[model samples]
Target chain A: MGVLMSAIGFGIVTASILAVSSVGFTLQFSVTNVFNLSFGSVMTGTGFIAYALNTSGVSIWASMAIGALCGGVISVALNWLIFGRFIRHGISRFGMVIVTIATGLICDNTIQAFVGPTFYAYNAQPGKAFNLAGMLLTGQELIIIVIAAVMMTATHVGLKSTRLGAAMRGLSVNASLARACGVPTRRVVAVAWFASGVMAGIGSVALFLDTSTFAATTGSQFLIMVIAAAVLGGVGSAEGAVVGALVVGLATEITAAYWNPELKDVVAFVVLILVLLVRPQGMFSQLSSERTAVG
Target chain B: MSAATQLYLATVSVYICVNVIASWALDIQFGVTGVLNFSFVVFQAAGAYTAAILSLGPSSSSGGFQRYVGGWRLPFPVPIIGAMVVGAVLAGVVGLVSLRRLRSDYQAMVMLVVSVIATIVAESQTGLVNGVAGISLVANPMVSLIHATRQTQIWIFVLFCVFCMALVGVVMYATVYSPFGRVLRAVRENDRAIEALGRNANRHRMQAFVIGGALAGLSGALLVEFIGAWAPNGWFYPETFVFFTAVIVGGRGSLTGVAVGAALVGVGVQQAVEYLPITLNPSVIASLEWIITGILTLVFLWTRPQGLLPERRRRFPTPWRSDAPELAERSAATKGDERG
Candidate 1:
C-alpha cells in the first residue's frame, strides 16, 4: 500500500512534466500540421541553455525564464526558416516530417559537438521531503506540480478567453477555413510556435530538475513518451494531453514498480502502439474526417 | 597496388556492396512500395544478431560476459540463410500490425517508436544478444577452408561479398522488371485504386516489406561476417535515415540508381567525411557526418526530388512483340502521369 501510494506520487510528478511537454508538442502539431520531430532537440537545446545559465550563477527561476525565451525564439525561427520554406515550396506534409527529422539531427548533433557527450548535473539541491497522506514528495516535486497546474489552467483560460488563443484554435481546426474566416493564420502560427516552444523550454527545465543529470540525447530519449502522450490525448487537444500524460505516467510508474524497472520505457511504446492501432485519431479527438493517408 | 591500399580498397568494396544491398532493400520498401519503414535498422540488427549467434555456437552459461539464444555452431551459408528467415519473419510480424491499422504518418511514427523500443530492450535485457555490449569475436564463416594468409583471406571475403552483391543485384533487377514490380508501383501510386481494382493493397505492401526485410537481413549477415562483431550501437535509428537518404539521393524506384546512390552516399560521402582532417574530436566528426547527411537529404528533397538519375520509364512490352505501339503509347502516357 505504501509503495503504491509513493509510486502514485511519483507518477503525478512525471505526469506534470509530461503534460507540459505533450501539450507543447500537440500545440505545434495542431497549428503547423507538422509533426515537428525536432521538438525534442529544442527541449535539449533549452535545457542546455538553462544549464549554462545556472552554471554561470543565475538563479534557477531566472535561468528557466531565459531558457524558455530562447526556446520560443528558436522554435519560431525553425518554423519561419525551415518548415515555413518547405511548406511554401509545396513540400508534402510527409516531406515536412522528413525535413523536421533532418532538423532534429542537425540540432541534436550541433549540441553534441558543442557540449560533448558527457552527462551534466543540474545544480539545484533537493529540498526536504514532505509526506502528505502517506505519499512522500520533495519540495521541487511539489513546486513542479503547482507550476504544471498553473500552466495548464493558464493555457485553458487563454485558449477559451483570449483572441490570440481563439485564432490559434481556429487555425488548428482548419488553416484555410480559418484564413477564410478572417483569422490571421500566419501570426497565429508564429504565436503557436512561440507558445509551444515556451512550454517545451519550461518543461525541459522541470525534466532536468526531476532527473538531475542529462546529456545531449536526454531530450530525444524522452521524445517518444511525449509523442505517445500527445497522440493518446488527441493530437490537438490541450486538456486531452494532460489526461493522456496522467494515464501514461501512472501506467509507466506502476509498471516499473510492479514489473521490471528496465521495461518502464517499453510501457509507453506499448500504449502508443495500442492507441495507434485502436484509434489513430486519438481518444479525445472530435475531428473524424482528418484521416491521414500516404502521399 | 601496395598491401595497405589493397586492403583499404577491399574494405571499401565490401562496405559498398553491403550498403548497396541494404539500399536496394530500402528502395523496395520506400521507393517502390512507398512505406516509410523507419524501423529498418531493427530488422537489419535482428539479422546480424541471428547470424552471429548461430555461428558463435550456444552461449556458455559459464562465460559471464554475454548471453543470447542459439549457439548452434551453424556452418557458413546456414547462418546467413538463418538471418534472412529471421528478418523476414520479424518484418512480417511488424508489418502485420503496423500496415493493417495505421495511416502512413502514424505508421512511420509507430515504426520509429518500435525502433527506439527495440534499442532500449536490447540495451536493458543483457541476455538478448548480450545487450548493449553486443556479441563480438564472431569467427569468419569458412575461414578454415582456405589455406591462405590473413590478407588473402580478406581478399577472398571481398570476392565473396562482390558475388553476393551481384547475386542480389540480379535478383533485385529481375524482381523490379517482373509483373509484380508493376503492381507494386501501382500500389505506391494509389493503394486505394489498387484496392478498388479488387487487389489487396495491404497484402502487396506486406509482401514487399517481407522481401525487403529478407534482403536487409542478408546485408546485415554479410556485414557482421566482415566485421566479425555485432552491437546495438551499430544499428541506431538514424542509420535508417542514412539508407533512406541514399535511396532518395540515388533516385527512387530504380535498381541501378540505388546502386549508384549507395556508392555515392554510403561509400563516397561517408568515407570522405570520415577521413576529413578536421581538428574536432572524432565523435564530433561522426556527428558531423549525420548532420551532413540530414542536410543532404533536405537539399535533395528541396531542389531535385527525383534524384540525379530518375527512375526510367517502366517498359511495358518485350521488343519481340510486333504489336507494341498501342501498349507503348499507353505506358508512356501512364508513365507521365505516375507520381510517387
Candidate 2:
C-alpha cells in the first residue's frame, strides 16, 4: 500500500511536469505543421536563463518569469528570422524537420560551449518535505502541480473565451481558409509560437525546481517524454496532453519503482512505439479538428 | 613538400576517400530516395563492431581492457566482407518494420527511436562490443608479410581507399542509369502510382536502404581498421544529420555534388578546426567546433536549399511508349489527383 501510494504520488508530479511542455509542443505542431525539433534547444536555453537569473539573487518566481519571457522572445525571433523564410519558399515538410533538428543541435552545442559543459545547479532553498498518505511530498512538487492546473485552466479559458485564441484555433485547422477569412494567420502563428515557447520555459523551470540541477541535454532528454505525452494525448488537444502526461508519467515512475530503475526510460519508449503503431492519428482526436472553433 | 607532409597528405587522402563513400551512400538514400536515415552512422558502427570482434583473436580477463562477443582470430578481408553482410541484413530487418506504410514524419521518428535504442543497448549490454569501454582491432593486417615502413603503409591505405571509391563510383553510375534506377526514381517521385503499375515500391526502397547500409558498413569497416579502435561514442544520431546536411548542401541525386559537399563538410569543417588558435580550453574548443558545424548545417538548409552545386538534369532520348494504353491512363489519374 505504501509503495502504491508513493508511486501514485510520483505519477502526479511527473504528469504535471510533462503537461507544461506537451501542451506547448502540441500547440506549436498543430499550427505550424512543422515539428520544431528545436523546441528542446529553446527549453534548455530557458533553463540556463533561469539559472543565471536565480544566481544573480532574483526570487524563483522572478527567474521563472524572466525565463518564460526569454523563451517567448526566442521563439518569436526564430519564426521571424528562420522558419518564416522556409515557409515562404515552399519547402517540403520533411526537409523542414531536418532543418529544425540541425538548428536545435546548433543551439544546444552553442549553449554547451557557453556553459562550459558542466551542469549548473539553480540554488533555491528547498522547502520542507512532508508526508501525505505515507508518500513523501516536497512543497516545490506540490507548487508545480498547482502551476500546471492553473495554467491549463487559463489555457482552456483563453481558447474558449478570447478572440486571439479563437483565431489560433482557426489558423491551426486550415491556414489558407483562415487567411481567406481575414484572420491574420501569420500573427496568430507568431503568437502561438511565443505561447508554446513560454510553456516550454515554464516546464524547464518546474523540472529544475524539483531536480535542482540543469544540463544542456536536460531538455532534449525530457523532449522524448514531452513528445510521448503530446502524441498519446492526441495532437493539438490541450486536455489530451495533460491526460496523456498522467498516463505516461505514472507508468514510467511505477515501472522504475517496481522494476529496474535503469529501464524506466525504456518503458516509456516502448509505450510510445506501441501507441504510435496501434493508433497513428492519436487516441483523443475524436471530433473534427475544426471543433477547436468552439473550444 | 617534405616527406612527412607527403605522408600526412596520403593519410588524409584515405580519410577523405572513406568518408566520401559513406557520404555518397547516405546521399543516395536521403537525397534520391527521401528516406531520413538517422541511424546511418549506426549501420557503419555495426560493421566496425562486427569486424573488430571477429579479428581480435581472443580476450584475456585482465590483459585486455574490455569484454566482448565473437572473440575469434580471422583474416582482415574476411571481416570486411562480414561487415557488408551485417549492414545488409540489419537494414533489411529494420526496413520491414519501420518502412511499413506510415506518415513520413512518423517514419523519421521511428528511425530516430531505432538509433537511440541501439545506442543505449550497445552501451548497457557489456557483452555486446564490450559496452562503453569499446574494442580495439589489431591495425597491422599485413605487417608481417609486407614488411613495409609506416610511410609505405599509409600510401598503401590511400590506394586501397581510392580503389574502393572507384568501385563505388562505378556501381553508382551503373545504378543511376539502369532500368532499375528509373523504377527507383519513379517510385521516389510517387509510390502509389508505381505500386499501381504492379511494381513493389517498398521493395525498391528496401533495396536502396540495404545497398546504402552495405556501403556505410564497408566505410565503417575500413575506418575502424585504420583507426584501430571502435567505441560506442563513435556513433551518434546527429552524425547522420551531418551527412544529411552535406547531401542537401551538395545537390541531391548528383555524385559530383555529394563529393563537393563531402569535401566542404567532412574535410573543410575538420580542417577549419585545426586552424583555430589554441587559446581557450581544449574541451571548450571541441564544443565550439561542434556548435559551429550544427549552425552551418542549419544555415545551409535554410538559406541554400539547392546547395553549392545544384543537380544537373539529364536528358535521355524518350523511348516510344509501346504500352501506351496503361501509361496514358496512369498519368491521367495522377494529374487528376493534383488538380483536385
Candidate 3:
C-alpha cells in the first residue's frame, strides 16, 4: 500500500509537469507542422529566466510568469525569423529537422557559455510537506497539479468556444484549407508559438521548482522524456498528450521504485519504442494510417 | 622538432584522421542513404571498447584503474581485427532490430533511444567498459619492435591511419559500384517501386546499416588507439549531429562534398579555434564554436540546402545547349564511380 501510494504521488507530480510541456509541444507541432526540437532549448531559456529573476529578488510565481513571457517572445521570434523563412523556401521535413537540431545546439551552448559549466540552484524555498498515506508530499507539487488541471480545462474550453481557438483547430486539421476558409492561418501559427512558449516556460519553472536547481543541459536531458511523453500521447492531440503523460509518469516512477534506478531512463526509452511499435496512434485515438506516416 | 612537440603533433594528427574517417562513415550512411542514425557514436564506442579490452590484458583481481571484459594484451593487428569483428556483430544486432520499414522520424527516435540506452548501460554497469571510469589503452604492441620514440610513433600511426582510410575508401568505392549499391540506392530513392521490382528493401537497408556500423567501429578503434582512453563521455548523441552538420554543409550524396564537409566543418572549425584569443574562457570559446556551427547549418539549409557544390542534376542535351551531354556524361561516370 505504501509503495502504491508513493508511486501515485510520483505519478501525479510527473503527469502535471509532463501535461504542461507536452500540451505546448503538441500545440506547436499541430499548428506549425515542425517537430521543433528546439522546444527543449526554449524550456531551458525559461528556466534560466526564472532563475535570474529569483536571484534578483522576485517571487517564484512572478518569476514563472516572466519566464513564460520570455519563452513566448522567443518562440514568436524564431518562427518569424528562422523557421518561417525556411518553410517559404520549400525545404523538406528532413531539412527542418536538421535546422531545429542546429538551432537547439546554438541555444544550449550559448546558455552554457553565459551560465558557465556548473549547475546552479534557483534558491526557491521548499514549502511544508503533507504526509498522505506515507508519501512525503510538497505544497508546490499540489499547486503544479492544480495548474495543470486548470490549463487543460481552460485549453479545452478555448478550443471549443473561442474564435481564436476555432481558428487554431481548423488550422491544425488542414492549414491550406483553413487559409482558404479565411482563418488568418499565419496569425494562428504565431499564436501557437506564443502559447507553446508560455507553457514551456511554466513547465520548466515547475521542473526547477521541484528539483530546486538549474543547468544549461537540464532541458536537453529532460527533453528525451518530454519527447517520449508527447509522441506517446499523440503529437496533434492535447488531450492525448495529458493521458500519455500520466501513463509514462506512472511507468517511470513505478520502475524506479521497484527496479534499479539506473535503468529507469533506459526503461523510459524502451517504453517509447514499445509505444511506437504497438500503437502509433496513441492509446485513446482511433487507428489512422496517417498517424504512423510521419511527424 | 622537439620530441614533446612532435608527440603533440602526432596525437592531433591522429585525431584529425580518425575523425575524418568516422565522419565519412556517417556521411555515407546518412548523407547518401538518408539514414539519420542517431546511434552512430555507439558503434565507435563499441570498437574502442573492444580494442581497449583486447589490448589491456587481464583485469586486476584486487584493484585496477579500469575493469572490462576480454582482457588480453594482443598484438596491434589483433586489436584492429577485434574492433572490426565487434563492430560487425553489434551492427548486425542493431540492424536486425531497427532497420525494418518504419517512418524516418520513428527510425531516428529508435536510434536515439539506442544511443541513450548504450550510454546508461556503460555508465551503470561497472563490469561493463569500466562503468564511466573507462579503460586506458596502452600503446605497447609495437613497443618491442619499434624504438618507442615519439617521432617514430607519430609517423607510424599516421601511416596506419592513411592505410586504413585508403582501405576503407577502396572498400566503399567498390560497394558504390556493386549491384548491392545500386539496389540500396533504388531502395533509398523509392522503396515501394523497388518492392514492386521484387527487391527486399528492408534487407538492403539492414545491409547498409550493418556495413556503416562496421566503418564507424573501425573509426572508433583507431581513435581509442590514438587517445589511449575509452570512456562513456566520449560518445554522445550530439556528436552524431556534428557529423550530420559536416555532411550537410559539404554536400550530400557526393564523396567530394562529404570529404570537403568533413574537412571544413569537422577539422576546419576546430582549427579555427586556434585563432581565438587565450584570454577568454575556453568553455565560452567552445560554446561560441557550437553556436556558429549551428547557425551556419541553418543558414545553409534556408538559403543553400543543396550546399557549396550541389548534387549535380543530370540533363538531356538539346540543340540550344549541346554541351549538356558532355557535362552529364562526365557526372554520370563520376556518379557511377561514387556509387561503388
Q: What lDDT tens digits, residue by residue, belong to model 1 across residues B1-340? A: 8899988898899999999999999999989988889999999999999899888877884375668866778778999999999999999999987898576777888899889989989998888888888998787774865878888888898899899999999998888778898889888888889999999989999999999999999999988988888888988788898898899898899888888999988888878887787677888987888888888889998887777788887555768878787779877887674333
- lDDT (CA) per prediction: 0.86, 0.78, 0.78
Highest TM-score scorer: 1
Error of 1 at A105 (Å): 0.3
lDDT of 2 by residue, A21-126 (tens): 8899888777777777888889999999988899899988789889999999998888787777766766676667877787788788888777876777887776
Docking class of 2: acceptable
Clashing pairs in 2: none
Candidate scoring better on TM-score of 1 and 2: 1
Order of quality (TM-score)? 1, 3, 2
* Winner of 1 and 3 under TM-score: 1
lDDT of 3 by residue, B221-330 (tens): 88887777878876877778877777778777555676677778876787687577666788888787788789879877866666666555434566676687787778
Best by lDDT: 1
Which sequence of candidate numbers ranks them by DockQ, best first?
1, 3, 2
Name the lDDT of candidate 1: 0.86
Worst 10-residue lDDT window, candidate 2 chain B:
B331-340
Instruction: Kindly report the docking quality category of candidate 1.
Output: medium
State the displacement of the C-alpha of residue B89, model 1, in Å, after optimal TM-score superposition. Answer: 0.3
| Candidate 3 global lDDT | 0.78
